[model samples]
Target: MRLKSVLAILLISISATSCSLYNKLVYRIDVPQGNYLQAEQVAQLQNGMTPEQVQYLLGTPMLTDPYSSYTWYYVYLQQKGYEDPEQYTLTVNFNQKGTVSDFNLDRPLPQQQDADIKPLELENNKSWWQSMKDFFSFS
Candidate 1:
């Protein structure tokens, strides 16, 4: 009976550990290769350029903001199956006159990076708890 109880506890522990490990293996939409555009290229796009012209230069946007067609979003993200992924986001907003009003390029979407790991300057800064938790946790 003692042996059976120990075995049961061990099994439970293993199952819990497995569950945590599986949680760490995050999967994401793979960003295609050789498609990053230069900032200069984006800047060359003047206001009053039609959607077709924009698409010709930058390809289709990942999404358009719901509020207006004036806002365009292009995004890229990459992750190793187990290692954390890196992200990049680009946003272009046009003015009422249909000219480029503002633009932004950012490290991947916040939600994507914010998942599993918080941003830090150094890998060493990652807490032992977070590291172990991440290493063991699978997606």
Candidate 2:
């Protein structure tokens, strides 16, 4: 019957529309796993820092082997919705006397750029009229 067909069509449309609406309305939270270390924190690390000092600055290591008591590992991972996870690792090796001997970092620590600071200082020092003149200047 036409009524039955119309009812079926209405149900299908409602279900289809509901599926799309559900996707739009639902929020997916980002899942962050493991330790997060900052560049400044890593920069604080020195070759001769004691285990306690390192631990104080960087917190406890995420992974440490039972057999390798002198080796400490700091790991960080951040995962967000549909994006590649960010990861970094730092490894510290202590000598027999318990002083930090050497270390390795998966990524280089970010350095403060003088060029970036210089531009901001220059911009702040310039007057509004000077900025406008500079903007319109051919050179």
Candidate 3:
């Protein structure tokens, strides 16, 4: 019957559309692979701090110049599927005495107003089922 054929076609169309919709709505876990540093921690750095102190406050440097022991680099990168990757770099130069002589941070230090700001949402932390539910939620 034509009605049966039409119903079959409609069902097929609905299934196809639903499959595409689900694919689009499905959340892919963000891949984060690198050192991550907080603005507050970077701001705590001060001139004349010893290398040991710097290492204590902030973790080990990501990269150090092979030829020069005076320069140290702290690099951070975060990759998220839905958002732009976040990156930061800090460079520290030590004096002959092995104390920090100067340093530079790629991003500006957080101000008082920024202290209350929250970090970006980490989608990888959410379960796939939760993400699916959130994807379909009205709010």
Candidate 4:
């Protein structure tokens, strides 16, 4: 009876303390914004294409310069909580004739998959046999 009471008190105190400890337990989702694009879409762009054609190919520009109507900006920003921000920019400029003149796609850092890097393993990945054993075990 005494052991049960001590165990109960200890568990309650530990849980109560853990709930108010450091705020690291909170989960943060990856924040992504702006027009998402693929390599094929960017490659399909051709010179002398009208704004309507460009829009059809690559959706609408995320930001259009208020001062200059001829310029279009396609920006992509992704923030992973535990990793450095991944981003890219695509700027399309049109001449006075109002057609696709020239554009730039700038990638400061290579794409995440370009490198053979793997994400952090927060929990152990057990094999099928081990998982079955664990499921059958009471403790």
Candidate 5:
């Protein structure tokens, strides 16, 4: 009976100490301001507007499609707690003449494979066998 009482007292003290330590270590959640380009402003873009004018209005595009420089894309992504993260996408397709041909808000893009180069792993390590293999394997 005495052992049970001591164990309960120890557990209560440990739990209280843990709670205090947790309160000190954990940080409060931060709320992000989920505001970006206004739809009304983007809707104002017209077919004849030049790149400079479009930039002036929308600040800057997030990316220019490598396949077509004429196409400009803008994207913003923000994630916070229980609220579903907000993502905005805008794409402006231009004619060959460098004028806006059409534009859309929140258009889906096809997934593309990344072609970025991987860092060199065996940059300096060249064992004699590796060197010999590299020299003779070319043929």
Candidate 6:
């Protein structure tokens, strides 16, 4: 019995130190939060879209102004144990009549680096198919 107890103590001490087996035993997961808007979904957004329509298309905004109902915010965050964190923000403003006035899809947080931000837009307010054609067409 004493020999068994000593062996147990030795095994516990071995696992307490950093080792490949220890690392595998401890699992870390990638975390993704908030509205995960795809590029295709964002391109579908347009002026005069109703709140309900917007919500249906893009799921839901992460934040909204309490003082004013005209603005909505969609924020995305991704954290990975082995890589750098990523964040995205989209701000949508509506008219008093509750129609989408305009939106910014590439707006970055103040602290985030500006290297990867790109504006998401459609030429002439065209749909996805039309935009794809426009991209392929030289003239």
RMSD in Å for all candidates = 15.8, 7.6, 13.9, 12.7, 13.4, 12.8
Question: Compared with the true structure, what per-residue lDDT tens digits does model 1 show for residues 23-62?
Answer: 7665645444323555566667775676677778888888
lDDT for each of the candidates? 0.72, 0.83, 0.83, 0.84, 0.75, 0.84
Q: Model 3 — which ten-residue stretch has the worst lDDT?
A: 107-116
TM-score for model 2?
0.58
Score every model by TM-score: 0.47, 0.58, 0.59, 0.58, 0.51, 0.57
Cα lDDT of model 5 by residue, 54-123, tens digit: 9889877878999879988877665544456667788888888888888887744333345676655664
If both were scored by lDDT, which would come out higher, candidate 1 or candidate 5?
5
Give the per-residue lDDT digits (tens) of candidate 3, residues 1-139: 9999999999999999999888768787777554567777887899999999999988889998899999999887766666777777889999999999999988863344766888867497997779889999997
Q: Highest TM-score: which candidate?
A: 3
Q: What is the lDDT of residue 13 in candidate 3?
A: 100
Candidate 3: stretches off by over 4 Å: 1-24, 109-139
Give a tens-digit lDDT track for model 2, residues 86-134: 7778998999988899988998744545675543345678888898899
Lowest lDDT block of 10, candidate 5: 28-37
* Candidate 4 residue runs with Cα over 4 Å from true position: 1-25, 108-139
Where's the lowest-lDDT run of ten residues in candidate 4? 107-116
Model 1 alpha-carbon miss at residue 70, Å: 1.5
- What candidate 2 gets wrong by more than 4 Å, as runs, is 1-26, 108-139
Cα lDDT, model 6, residue 4: 100
Deviation in Å, model 3, residue 76 alpha carbon: 0.6
Q: Clashes in model 5: which pairs? A: none
Alpha carbon lDDT at 138, candidate 3: 100
